[model samples]
Target chain A: MFQGRIIDTKLRKLSIQDAEKFIASSDFGASIFFSGTVRNQNDNKSVIGITYDTHDALVIQSFEEIYNEANEKLEIKNKAVFIDHAKGYLNLGEISIIIAVATKHREEAYKLSRYIIEEIKKRSPIWKKEHYQNSESNWLKGNPLVNEKN
Target chain B: MKVKIELFGATRDFSDQNILELSLNNDSTIEDARIEIIKYLKKNFDGNKDFVRIVNTSAFSSENNNIVSDNYKIKNNEKIAIIPPIGGG
Candidate 1:
């Protein structure tokens, strides 16, 4: 099973407990959870907050694509995967993303968790704008999207 | 003919709106739309070269949410989106 969603701050907050609950199961012996937090500093500047913008429909599509790719590449068929990302301004030390995986062993769980996050960063149409302490903010340059079919 | 493009991420600050409208000739391709967007960005945000670079590197996704190539024909009132570089965890 795979679950991916964007947590809109206006509606709800992204939480670890929800991710844990989604992937909890007696069928798996290992559960790996990864949470990406907004830190205080970036490029030596004080990061007061970050606002994450996403193309909602395309993002959901990318999530499903990533999950399917992980399934094929890792060869781990029976598993539970939960991914939730925040879609609004997050203060320092706030959780921006959570990737939880439950599999039959620790190795697949760890590999799947890492693989999904990396692929999401590369493929998903999500952007981050960092607000500094002095009231200045800038959008961080990210990996350019390249379509192989183009 | 005209096309409406939904802006996201860094482009949001440039236009100050989520959607941008561009006028084009008949049967204009996605490449033409890209050029028009670059012109609009340059004309409005003249001093900012960074945003222009974003336009150059961006991809256009059709209403169906699939990335279309530069040669894809543009239809009147077709809603598309300019997807800039992405970075998420």
Candidate 2:
């Protein structure tokens, strides 16, 4: 099972409990989940919140590629992958994203979980805007990842 | 030929609209499309060239989703995307 979504709304943060329930029925023995929350500070400034944005069609395509590519490298089998990204705005300490991977073995489960999140960050057509405590919000870099890294 | 340019993240915010359309010469290359889009961004959308990039949507469906160059030729009714540096996790 592969589930990937961009939840674009002004609602409250998502719950990791829901993600665990979604993974509950997995027949695989090993499961690892990762959740990213909004931080209170970044790069020396106080970060109040962040607004995430995405183009869904391309986002979905990127997630599929991440899953397939990870499997090719990691021998992923009987696996379930799910990733949900929060769009709109999120407050500090709010759940911004969730990633859960289930596999027949613990190693593959852990490895794929990391790979999936990294790929989504690296390839997914998603963007973020950081709202500071006192200053105007600043838009973070967009989808051309490597150029920004270099 | 006409091409639709989609914007996401900061690009969408800068442009205000998620999609922009351009009509180009039939023989226009991707380079032409890019110049036209950038011109529109500066003129109408208050967009800054230094903060933006052109991403070929066609290349995304291939094995590698690398951004294509301006030398690539444009197709009729093709849709391209104007992307900024991605910050999502």
DockQ of each: 0.63, 0.44
Query: Least accurate stretch of 10 residues (summed lDDT) in model 1 chain B?
Result: B47-56
Query: Candidate 2 on A1-150: residue-level lDDT in tens?
Result: 788877765755576776777777648899888999999888898999998887677788888888887756877756888888888888888888899888888988889998888878877777888999897898775456433210
Residue A11, candidate 1: alpha-carbon lDDT: 78
CA RMSD (A), model 1: 2.0
- Superposed Cα deviation of residue A53, candidate 1 (Å): 0.2
Best-performing candidate as measured by DockQ: 1
RMSD of each: 2.0, 4.0
Best by TM-score: 1
lDDT of 2 at B8: 66
Question: Positional deviation of A42 in candidate 2, in angstroms?
Answer: 1.5
Candidate 2 residue B36 C-alpha distance from true site, Å: 1.4
Q: Candidate 1 residues B14-54, lDDT tens each?
A: 67668999999999998899888878877888837887788
Compared with the true structure, the alpha-carbon lDDT of candidate 1 equals 0.88
